[model samples]
Target: MKKGFRFLLKTIMWFMVITFAFVVLFKWVPVPVTPLMVIRYFEQDSEKRTFWKHDWESIDNISKNLQLAVICSEDQNFLNHNGFDIEAIEKAFEYNKKGKRVRGGSTISQQTAKNVFLWPQRSWLRKGLETYFTFLIEVIWSKERIMEVYLNSIEMGKGVYGAEAAAQYWFKKPAARLTQYEAAAIAAVLPSPQRYKASPASPYIQGRKAWIVKQMHFYGPFSYDKK
Candidate 1:
């Protein structure tokens, strides 16, 4: 029993050490494997797709509309929550019970943690890792950093990652100049961007855009600076 306990402790310590190392390394390194980058590599060969890479300083950076739209669509109480929002989780559970796959309680921080560091899958183990990383990022990163990473890493289309890519692809403009409607359209397809095109012409896309616009007004502003 003593030996077994020692082995488990050592294993956990090693895992923590490795995780911390990667976190520090990636903080300085531009991660090469964004969702859209990976998809583009496989879908149409990486050479064909134009992957927009911009740091936070680009004037056409992610607009306030884009940020607010994401908050409104993903987590209304993102500013108030810690790593997890229990009330939103419970509400999501109740909503799902009613035959509606209409809710996810993930805050911007949690979403950024998953998008930047984890893979796409639904498993208890993956979710556990997500929670762990979510906690780590929330503790280590500011709310602005979380929002910036989320905007930069989210999958906007098959070969599109980040606001700049999506903006250029969909609206033929830069990300910083995206209108509320354009931002809403981008945020609306976030749930299944690979499947749903981010254009305003499709009926379902247009309806989703409108719904998100309504939600934006309902949720109001997210003040990350305050909390």
Candidate 2:
């Protein structure tokens, strides 16, 4: 029992050490790829050739409109939270408990952690690791860096990843050049990137885009400069 306990302790210690180093390394480096990207590629039909598109753009190069649009559409408290938004979590929990459609309360920071360090499946272990990585990133990375990595790594459409790639894929323009409505359209499809179109929108995507644009207006002009 003593030997087994020591082995478990040592294993956990090594895991923490390695993961911490990994997170710190990514603080400055661009994330090359994500687990979700790989998983999605394999999930495609093997009979047909599959394509993957991703381009890394610095936070400065990505449009402020897109940054703000995602904040409005996904996490309004993104700028204020310490990696978690308690109120949103509570609401999602209550809503799910009431037998309504399930919703996620993840903050942008939390989503960044999962996208950068973990997989896409919804297991308790994955959730726990996501929380752990989220704390690590919030401690080691700046808000701008977190947003940069998030914008550069998240899946935006089928075979499309990141703001840069999504911009070109959907609008035939670079990420830095996307307009407010264009950015909102991209953000509107985030809830189900693979299932929805970011351009030539269906009625559902158009309505979501309108709502997100309204929210972005209320959010006002956005800047990542520290106040």
Candidate 3:
């Protein structure tokens, strides 16, 4: 019994050490690729499985419009939240319990944690780890760093990832040059990136984009002053 308990405890300690190291490393290093990027590659048809696009642009290089647009559309209280938004989670729980269209009240920090470290799946195990990583990143990385990683890592289209690639693919421009409508269009499709196009906008996307733009205006004069 002593031997078994010692092995389990040592295993857990090693895991914690390794995960903490990675979290601290990412605070200063650009994420080259994410688990989702690899997972999505294999999930596609064999002929197209190799297709992938991602470009890491500094947060300063990505347009402020895209940054604020995502904040308005995905997480209104992103700047204030630690890792989770209790009110949003409660609302999601209530809505899901009612059997309406399922909703996730994940804050930007939570989403960033999942996108960077965890696989894209719905499970209690993944959710638990997601919570763990979210807390780590929130504690270790600044808000600007969090947003920078998010803008540079999320899957924005079928094969495209990050604001830089998404801007070039959808708008034929760099991320730094995206206009407000262009930014909102990209943000609007984030919920279902594979099914939506930022350009040649669908009516549904157009409507969502308009709403996001309005929210961005109400969000008002956004800036991320790195400290």
Identify the leading candidate in terms of lDDT: 3
What lDDT does the true structure give each of the candidates?
A: 0.77, 0.92, 0.93
Model 2 lDDT, full chain set:
0.92
> Which 10-residue window of candidate 3 scores lowest in summed lDDT?
218-227
Candidate numbers sorted by lDDT from highest down: 3, 2, 1
lDDT, candidate 2, at 23: 92
Estimate the TM-score of every prediction. 0.83, 0.97, 0.97
| lDDT (Cα, tens digit) per residue for candidate 3, span 1-227 | 99999999999899889999999999999999999999988899998567679989999899999999999999988887788899999999999999868899999999999999999989999999999999999999999999999999998999899999999999999999999999999999999899999999999999999999999898898555422
- Model 2 sits at a Cα RMSD from the real structure of 1.2
Residue 169 CA displacement from its true place in model 3, Å: 0.5
Residue 3 of model 2 has an lDDT of: 100
Candidate 1 at residue 51, lDDT?
A: 49
TM-score of 1: 0.83
